[model samples]
Target: MSSTTGSPSPDPLDGPLAAADLDALVDEWGDWAQVADLLDVPRTKVGTLLREHRLAAAVPRPGAGQRVPLAFVQDGEVVKGLPGILTVLHDGGYDDRECIAWLFTDLGLPGRPIDALRENRGSEAKRRAQAMAL
Candidate 1:
């Protein structure tokens, strides 16, 4: 007799991390409109960034809509090395949520992968991202 009142099945597209968990890991987030404002581009062009793997966004939590981690941008542009790292992770079959979670997770790096990228030590983060593919 299976019950129908427990937690719902996880969405396959949500990747391995829960939305709340992903939300907790990020300090700041911005929707595409905000991202456009930051990038000084029309809102429509923001979609191009995601398509190019120059940025990654996720719903964060139910009803939260899509949001990008603010750490991925700095100085009015996508942070240097972030695109390459994101590309690597995406190529490794990690979805947007997984990619964001991985970036914020501390796997014995000097800090989280996002932190390393912010500090301009993206080579270290990129190395880990590459290893994930294998």
Candidate 2:
């Protein structure tokens, strides 16, 4: 999933993590391990957090197996629907796992944590709502 010749630029998906997409299935099921993989963070980092019991949810099960299978998204679902979270991270001076950690922590909202993943998809809606006041 790293850079490749003629490969799409990083942050290919838009807005938050596109709920329709489950490429991050591991995150949904794998706990920190999958989340780390999706975010490209070192397993050790996330693992350490788990060992220390920092995460709010249950600690991920042992092994790197897919506790939660990942879901994939079509290109349009990401590009057409949202600015893509990867782009936001790129713009936010984030790279690699730290960026992902920041995203997770920020998106780990009180309710509907996944809604943060859809931030980009609804950005236009946000703008429209703001525009409605005018």
Candidate 3:
């Protein structure tokens, strides 16, 4: 459900967003169809986009596909810099689940990375991810 070529299984949660809290996280996310509607693309394109790392799912859905966090979508499009930030984190050796956990965890910024993205602070998040690569 991650944006990687092979959807890696989620890592163990070591932050505020623990794996045990996934049920609550799912409530804040949406399915592929909803993501498609937000992006104004076909459902197939949604899958393509996800596979291409244009966006990412918070986690894998119980059955199939993933539920993308609403924070990643803005005005019916993926937020700017999100893909780049994801790439930075991935390049830093963080898997999809780790990325999710980090975003939900506060990095001493004004808020969590996901909250920063939702508030149009993706650049800050990207900067932090870049620093993480050090």
lDDT of each: 0.83, 0.36, 0.70
TM-score of 3: 0.73
Clash pairs, candidate 1, are none
Residue runs of model 1 more than 4 Å from their true location after superposition: 1-20
The 10-residue segment with the lowest total lDDT in model 2: 69-78
Candidate 1 lDDT over residue span 1-134, tens digit each:
87699776443335564343777788899999999999999988889999899899998878999999988889999988889988888898878888888888876678888888888888878998899766
Residue 14 CA displacement from its true place in model 1, Å: 16
Off by over 4 Å in 2: 1-26, 29-83, 106-114, 119-121, 124-134
Whole-model alpha-carbon lDDT for candidate 1: 0.83
Model 1, TM vs. native? 0.84
Worst 10 residues of 1 by lDDT: 11-20
Q: Residue 99 error for model 1, in Å?
A: 0.4
Q: What is the lDDT of candidate 3?
A: 0.70
Residues 1-134, model 2: lDDT tens digits: 66566734223224333222233323554555565676466767655533332222222233444322222122212223222443444345543332232333323243122243354344543233234223
- Show the lowest summed lDDT stretch of 10 residues, model 3: 11-20
